[model samples]
Target: MNGWSNHLIVAPILVPLVACAILLVIDERRRVAKAMVSLASTIVLTAIAIILFAIESGPSGFEGVYLVGNWAAPFGIVLVLDGLSAMMLLLTALLAVASLVFSFARWHAVGAHFHSMFQVLLMGVNGAFLTGDLFNLFVFFEVMLAASYGLLLHGSGQLRVKAGLHYIAVNLVAALLFLIGVSLIYGTAGTLNMADLAARIPEMEPDRRMLMEAGAGILGVVFLIKAGMWPLCFWLPTAYSAASAPVAGIFAIMSKLGIYVILRLTMLLFVEGPSAGFGAQVLFYGGMATLIFGIIGVLASQALGRVAGYSVLVSSGTLLMVIGINDGAVSSGALLYLVSSTLTISAFFLLIELVERGQDAGANVLAVTMEAYGDAADEEVPEEQGVTMPGTMAVLGICFAACGILLSGLPPLSGFIAKFAMLSAMMGTGAIGVPPTAAIWSLIVLVILSGIAALISMTRAGIRTFWSSIEGTVPRVLVIEILPVMFLLGLTLALTVQAGPAMQYMDATIRTLSKPSLYIDAVRTAAPTGGDVKSSSSEVESN
Candidate 1:
């Protein structure tokens, strides 16, 4: 494969956008057309990701950069393909396909627009991952947000509408702040390209540097808000709970976008000078707070949907904490955890929806009575009368167990691999700035406690849903319902079995991320004009 082939980078993004366009023109009622387009596009995207990964992992070990339109960096748009972007793209493709499969049976209950919006959202997400410019990142964020608006309110129920409105309002504010931050940086640095900005930022004046730091600080808050960080994430649970199962699963991917950008930019562009160490502090404290809030939310929530929502919050917190530590090894672990938790939580949400549907069906059927004379009847249906489909229960049980295991970080699972990686990295001295003393031990203790809390809460909920007897017999599970859980669980197991390659991939990704020069060289060398600029710490600090 040609290293400079921009199509490899662009295909994953364009395919989905093109599919969304084609889906819009087709008849809305044609389910076959929708499924064909979605599934085909997903497969193509996944294949493209795999190809890109293979090419990068070839004898050269890494493909540095693939410039877009043969234009040089600091002037023309660039698309840099390295470890981080590849890993993110692969994960997004995999999860998007899984979520789409999960939605197959519920398509009729939702609508054609549901699937259309989903493809659009995927396009935005992939584009965000591949783009090398900050402005393009914001554009993709808006695209995804727009699609989410429709998906969040696909059913148009009162609760969905209310939740959607809140979600929109909060994210719009975050978007506005994001733009402001971009403008501040552009005004100070005269460029929006991440590579160029990084190269030029180190030479900036002290005051200007402080201003850039302030701007970055504000921008970090916006990302934290998007990631559902503590104190600012109150809207996530309500909004996520109200969305349809597939929509919620898709939404799960959205939060990671903000975190990914934060990690990428902070480590690459922001960690060059005196202020390099400060952001980590923010991440650490924010993570701890977010973790506490999530646990409290889980303890307080009674509904299944809300509990899953809280789990997302906790996971996001944990990720931030790992990132804040600034250890590549730990970051790799967090990356793995992010992928595993995403799948498990999404499966759990789907299972909750199934349980809700079964209960609702039974309640509705029992609420009314048939009569020959057509007289009004006032017989009330017991809430516990819903039949538990054995197949559905079995699948839900498996999904719930997967969720519990992932949350608890048990052995032989992806979560375990991820946690073990972080622990190993932490145990090694000189890996992070934090001293290896009682304080570090305390931090580890807190993390363990959080994991235990999540495990206990999730286990209790699983027992109630899967093992406890209701008033009626178990309902039959639809094949469609079981498909998503099976697929996700299978993937999780595969990750466990093939931990070596995956870890190698993650380590390679971390190495690439840690070294921004590889990315810079690719863009600079690929530029048609051959004007290469070296990044300076002072310039980055000022910008």
Candidate 2:
């Protein structure tokens, strides 16, 4: 049992891959089989994540690295199960399961292979989370990207195809840059393993140091592109809006992939000293810009889908800002925000799809009702085919309110907890320097402004759609369609109840990340060579 527990680190990664493989072989017409595969895999993955979290909660503080084939670091593959990875794995599992549940009825609406592609995408995301090698990160990233390519255009309409092209072009460039950066790092350090590279980084020659920094900087840009940071996020709203509802819901979580890697690499490998790196300033500025753009875009857009897409851009910006701030409190806050915002946004997206569909089916029913009531006097009656039910409108209203409040960091919500944590971190008694102070303040203002914009737009839309007089009978919302939204609401409430423990866990995770020597030592000791890598181990000490 102990041996099995120690090997649990690989399960999160393997479960999804195995599920994907099984899904690929299943008959697409066998919807039951596909749903079972997805649900069972997600449940098992979530269970494993919870178990790992409990195991890491013990006095040791981390589960340590799980080396594949007993190969030591700097040579063999490894998967590190630290606090960050465990938390992320758990969050991803939760969201994935929620998404799968939402898709129970809607999967066929999208297509036959939708579930298969979804599982493949999950495989990529989970693999990325568990990988301890930088090169493997690239492989997982590409895996996710390829699956996304299929999912994004699953419906294959003109708009989707066009939007997907833009998404593909941008990500391809980012992937190339990522590969180039990794090659440079490997060429200079003579190793591709994260732990070993961190140990060797401080001892590199001056020129080599500059080369690696350049590579890291380029790599940072690649992640920023993935994270939808300013100037690079132009394609996000369009592509996401054009995707099928379920695919869009899943993609909302996908944007976090870049930020996750940035957080991991920045703290674990790049935190040598102030003079040793460019700091997180670039990320901060980019995030702030992206936030502003997203707010403006949200306000400018009328369609619910596009509005939600822009909101995602804004959330991504805030997340990157927190990462760039690089304080333990800030990072913890970001993690909290990341998990909450993703759920809220995903729920919102799912709700939008339901509303859109229901509206289409209820338009005529609503038009007739409006004619009978004679309330159509001043209003432009919606096309009979486009009207939606009151119940569907109510659910949409609730989801929008939740998403807006949570995304904007309002009090008594998960988003607020995350924001407050970040604000506390940013105000940390001069730790971030004067420049950072200005940046932090700017971010705070941006967050408030964006929230206000979102509130106004969403409220206006909700009032017009839900409260205003309509001519037709409301459409019925399927239980499966509403289940995911309710689950997300419960999650948001749970976050509030468990805020204390959640924050503590995030803090501990950040602290563990801030001190990588403990991680390096663990890997060294656990290596098959049994701490034989003296130079690498000692180099970390000097740093």
For model 2, where is the 10-residue window of minimal lDDT?
Answer: 528-537
TM-score of each: 0.88, 0.89
User: Which lDDT tens digits does candidate 2 get at residues 128-167?
Assistant: 9888888998998999999999888887889999999999
Best by lDDT: 2
Q: What is the C-alpha local distance difference test score of candidate 2?
A: 0.78
Candidate 2 similarity to native, TM-score: 0.89
Q: Provide the lDDT at 227 for model 1.
A: 90
Off by over 4 Å in 1: 1-5, 58-64, 360-392, 430-439, 529-543
- Each candidate structure's count of clashing pairs: 19, 10
Model 2, position 414: C-alpha lDDT score: 88
